[model samples]
Target: LDRLFARHEALRSVFVAPQAKPRVEILPPDAGLPVSEHDLRQRADTEAALSDLCHEEERTPFDLARGPLIRGRLVRMSDEEHVFLLTQHHIISDGWSMGVLVRELGSLYRAFVAGQDDPLPPLAVQYPDYAAWQRQWLSGERLQKQAQYWREALSGVPSMLALPTDRARPAQQSFAGASVPVVIDVDLTRDLKRRSRQHGTTLFMTVLAAWAAVLSRLSGQNDLVIGVPSANRGRREIEELIGFFVNTLALRVDLSGEPSVSELLERTRRTTLAAQEHQDLPFEQVVEIVRPPRALDHTPLFQVMLAWENHAGPSFDLPGLSVEAADGLDQVK
Candidate 1:
């Protein structure tokens, strides 16, 4: 809480003339932090309470946190197991921030259990600090040259993946996507590793190539557009700091002929290298500067996304928790 909004002056800057600064505040001691241990229909109920919570404060957009933006009620089914119902205002949190928040919550909870009131050191910097650096650092001749390469490489490229959709796209360009994972069996995985070693390409490059091939076949388009998220935090200070510190790199492939997996992989490697070399630019900026034709029928760039993430560590000693994979929520592209 101390270092979180520290860097983003917008976070700390007040929306009201009366108040000087915005801040993250802990609820007073003996505050009954209501918790829901089960999947309960408490969003409406809790939000009503938080709405009242907001009314008590000044009429300021920034007083939202103290309201109910990130509402996580404690769910204490038993002494050993207590979970939280975490909800956030999309304005302050993104997919990346959710992961970071959960991890930090776990750390803080563990520290409280160990009788430590305050837990964790101040981060060397925060997202705002990095944002400032990015605005200043990503400029000059080097940035321009790399951008020139991107412009030439992406010129005249179609922006959509042509995935078959059930209904015609809406005027608003709303999209819903799902992904499915087909894990290789033990024997198949072993053989795949042996072949990967022979080809001298890492497992990720091979998998990305195969996925690209599959998409090319499904879409019936000779060209494939895939977006991969790259962690843009190269500096040590912001490595652990949390925010939307990621950039999307568009991976394009021209599958004119039925290229072998090896050939596809070589192209994929070249494409990835080019992306990484100039990935410092953010997607929003790219769109603004490139001035792609604004069309309701087209996405600004890239269609499909491929991602690999590691969230769990050492995978042990978690208790009183039930984890289930629901097919409805797990959608595949």
Candidate 2:
């Protein structure tokens, strides 16, 4: 825990706001992380007790300003069984960072258990340094060029998607949402990948093409815009650092002229390529440039979002510790 905290500056960062401009304040590393231990072996229903405990932990929100911003817990279910829970604020970490955290933790824990020196090399740069570089880099003609491209590309787009819903649209939008798991069998998954390759595009672009098609058919709107998150870690310097480097891109897909699947794929490919080129222009800046009409009920550019998570859970090969995914609310958390 000490090694991980010492290495990544973001782990000790807190956001300070209400100023002229908000900024992140990176604090010095603490002696150790805030961790709690619980033993539920004496309980009659250990599984249920553990589930409740995890749910409670997740619901407890973090204070961004006065924060370690991360917490950990160890639960003992039996003499041989245990579960380690680690939680962090979304501001401090992302999918890439999580992978780094787990991998580093495993490496550090292994060396500690064996009573050896830390094997990992020091980080080249921290998150704050990257932030400084970003502010300096994205300015002047470079920022304006990207901003102009987005304004022209998104001109005259429909204010909102006319998605048909079972219930009438509420005056004030509530973000109460639910997830329905759809199983795509292996054969279908394989075919999708194969088709993506044939189209000279990625799996994400292909899936995005399908989504745009579905939304167009349902909403009866030929022109559609959907938001997709990009890791924004193209630069080699910040790729390994833990920070909020993820950015959203408003992808506009035109389904006019009743194009076939192949034609749609081509359109999607082009749109993705263009977005990738101009992705450095932050989403907030893009909104300012486009000046899309805003409403209290909804967002300006895109309502629905698609996040392509190409990362899987980290592997923990520690002795006597079995790590597996939990079910239901635990999985959601």
Candidate 3:
């Protein structure tokens, strides 16, 4: 963990004056880890206790300006069994960072166990460098070029979708929400993949079009905007870095005239490719350029978010320790 902190500057960084003249402060390498240990071997209801711990860790908010935005907890359930919980603020990390974190952590653990020197190569670029590059490269004419596309694409877009709900929307929007898992069985999963290939689209594009169709039918609206996350790591150098590089893309799902499935997929393919081409411009900037009506009740451009995480799940194989992802504990959520 200490090695990870040293390797990645983001782990040691904190935001200052986030609302005004925002900047990051990287702490010293000597700063200690925030990991805590809890012994629950004497407890009878270990599973229940573990679940509560997970929820508590997740719900505890981070102090962005004060310092460390990441946390760790080690729970000793029995003589050999243990659970490791890690939490971090979204400002510092994203979905792709998890795979990098786990893989590097495993490599470090293995090398330490064998009494070998650090085997991982030095990072060519840090997260701060990437941020600097974005500021430098994505500006002036480049920014305007992409900004024009967003303005034209999102011209006169509806402020919000007429999504049906059992209860009325609150006066103000809140982050409080719960997720229910939707299972896609093997045959259906295979068929979806097959259909994606048949339509010359990726699985994400296919599922996205289908989700837009469902939302259109449910809301009784043909025009819809759905928010999707784009892993904004186009450069290979940034691929192994740990940072918040994910960008949101508001896709205009035009479900007019009851188009056939194939036609919809084709349309989706074109929209997705175009969005990808213009994805370098951050979502915040896109929102600013689009200039949708603002309200306290909902987000500006889109309400529905579809995150199709296609990254491979991380696997941990520490020396003489069994690690498996706990049910109901999602890192993404």
**Count of steric clashes across candidates, in order:** 7, 0, 0
What C-alpha lDDT do the candidate models reach, one value each?
0.59, 0.85, 0.89
What tens-digit string does per-residue lDDT give for candidate 2 at 173-204? 89877999888899998999999999898999
Per-residue lDDT of 260-280 in model 3, one digit per residue for the tens? 999999988988899989999
Off by over 4 Å in 2: 18-21, 329-333
lDDT of 1: 0.59
Residue pairs whose backbone atoms clash in candidate 3: none
Candidate 2: TM-score?
A: 0.93
Tell me each candidate's TM-score. Answer: 0.70, 0.93, 0.93
Worst 10 residues of 3 by lDDT: 324-333
Q: State which candidate, 1 or 3, has the greater TM-score.
A: 3
Model with the higher lDDT, candidate 1 or 2: 2
